[model samples]
Target: MHYQITLAREVFCEGVGLHSGKPATVKILPAPENTGIVFIRTDLTDRPRIEAVAENVTTTLRATTISKGNIRIFTIEHLLSALHVYGVDNCYIEVNGEEPPVQDGCSAYFFAVLQKAGKKIQNKFRKEVVIDKIYRIDDGERFIIALPYDKFRISFTSLNEHPLIGTQYADFIVTEDVYAKDIAPARTIAYEKEIKHLQDMGLGLGGSLENVIVYNDAGWINKLRFNDELVRHKILDVIGDLRLTGGIVKGHFIAVKSGHQLNTELAKEIRQGGC
Candidate 1:
């Protein structure tokens, strides 16, 4: 039987948030069994602790944000994705700002942190959710296809208006080693035209060529980590958002032109007491 697990020791890091663009230091600590993943906002007076669950997700614009009453944390998908890959069942994540640092716009940094901190098995059996049927969700231009499987897997197809990024695809069966090599290093990407629009919406304030892959007709503004990185990044975000289901989801999720909103909705649908 698989046991629940958490970090063996504390891990600390700091950087600029992808959304708020504010500075933040995160302290990740081990938690007891059944605690789930919780984010504590140390900057607030009340020090609100928000749970990472589909219902608590407050925003899904370019990233996922979870809130509880007066406090909210932004751009947490990357860290969550790392936790999922490592099979971390419980953790206490404390942050000093409103959003998590978006290092290189990928899950690699978080994976390193968790890897360094190590894993400690808890005394309780880890909970798992097995898909019992086909679950589908669509938002007009995009949709998700979730099918019963014995592993957490994904196949993503991304279509963009950019000439160089006309069509891209990614597929994976998630595991610690597999994810770290195949998906964790893929950086978040955006088109050249969306910069001004995103900035106007008060998003991507800390964005730069150093952290995000900015593409246009000219091609990768910062060079390529993977030629099909755009689609792989989409799968990374999907992996992150789906972790909000609070356990491992045994299924193959096929997403097309989907973002955080659709990802969280699919998690929400399956989480309404499972398949």
Candidate 2:
């Protein structure tokens, strides 16, 4: 590919952080080719720059990405996912506080704002880190594997372990059209018990019925877009976490109950020539 793209103009959104309970504002600005996606902590006086890279990953408590040169931002997966699928080659995301807004706990808001701004293609060719072999990592029962493939692909399996979630399997061929329609609207879900625990820990401060699916021991309070929505969300997360590699990836991912920690580790492995 001889072209790279960025937003045509700036876009803005504001909301509270699900974990921090603090309000935040995010602004997206188009960047030149080779700039990549970077997060600027404008709330700080020094204004630290945090590259969305696996090496910068500091935490993965409830969601992915907590990189910082000084202060940290929490829960950046959904916004990052939107950027990845939308093929945003380079951009500067300035957050007035830690954490991007958990708008609806999905990528829909980011997509809408990005679509409205349109995209500008640059002259430089884009680059991708291709997987050349099978590389795997595991944490307890969770595991993620990257196998050689030409186009990006993902397969996921999740067992909610509750009567409500059961076990789910989902697969997708990664592409913009498929992501926009099939994956972008799927919201993050949580068990009521977990939500309570998160709240007790002073986390998930911004979680609500409107932004997240609340599942009880019995079943979901609402319906899901797909039968395997839980697994599909896991796939969406992998796409976002892998973007920390600083470019596109050409590989097939086989994930079994894998979370951000494992996904980030796999990206590091790939960069180290382990895959």
Candidate 3:
């Protein structure tokens, strides 16, 4: 039987927030079975806690943000993606700021750290969300469809107007090994023309060439880890976003130009549907 798992020991990392640009440190600690993934803002006086679930998701602009009353956490997708892939069911993520560190703008660092921490199996059996029917969310141009499948999988098609990154497609059965080697290392992508506008809006201030892959009208400003890195990153985001369902999902997701908003919406639907 599949058992619930948590970190073997506490582990921590430090970096700057992708959007907030503020320096922050995050510590992951083990929790008991059935606790689920939770986040705590240690910088606040009350030290409010927010469970990482779809119901707490408040914003999905450029990133996913979860809130509990006035307290909030931002840009949590990368970290959650790593934890989900690692099969971590229960943990406490303690952070010194509103956002977790944007290490290398990808899940690779987080995945490596989690691997080093190892896993502790609990007595309780894990419950997974098994999709028995199709669930679809469409917004004209973009759409996401969840289909019944025995394994966790994703088939994504990314579309961009830029000639350099017009259309790309990829499908994979997301296993821990595949995620660590193929999906986790893909860095976040941004456009040169949008950088100034994003910074002006008080976002992506901490982003740099070392972390984000930027491209201009002519071509990419930074080297790509893969020719279809952008679509792979989209799959990474979808994995993280879906983890908000509060359990491992057993199904296949087919997406076309789906972003955080659509991903989270489908997550909420799945949760409410009790699938």
- For TM-score, the strongest prediction is 3
* lDDT tens readout by residue for model 2, 1-275: 64888999999999888778788899999999999998999988988888887888887877876665557877888888889878888999999988898888788788888888889999998887778888999877999999888888999998766866778888899898888877888888888878878899888888888788888867788777777777777888899998887887888999998999999888777777743
Off by over 4 Å in 3: none
**Of the candidates numbered 1 and 3, which has the greater TM-score value?**
3
Q: By TM-score, highest first, what's the ranking?
A: 3, 1, 2
Off by over 4 Å in 1: none
Q: What lDDT score belongs to each candidate, Candidate 1 first?
A: 0.89, 0.84, 0.95
Ranking by lDDT: 3, 1, 2
- Which candidate leads in lDDT? 3
How does model 3 fare in lDDT?
A: 0.95
**Tens digit of lDDT per residue, candidate 1, span 72-176?**
898999999998888888999999989988988999999988999999988999888677898888978999988988888999999977778889988898888
Residues 1-275, model 3: lDDT tens digits? 69999999999999999999999899999999999999999999888999999999999989999999989999999999999999999999999999999989999999999999999999999988789899998999999999999999999999998899999999999999999889999999999999999999989988999899999988999999999999999999999999999998889999999999999999999999888
Candidate 3 positional error at 191, Å: 0.4
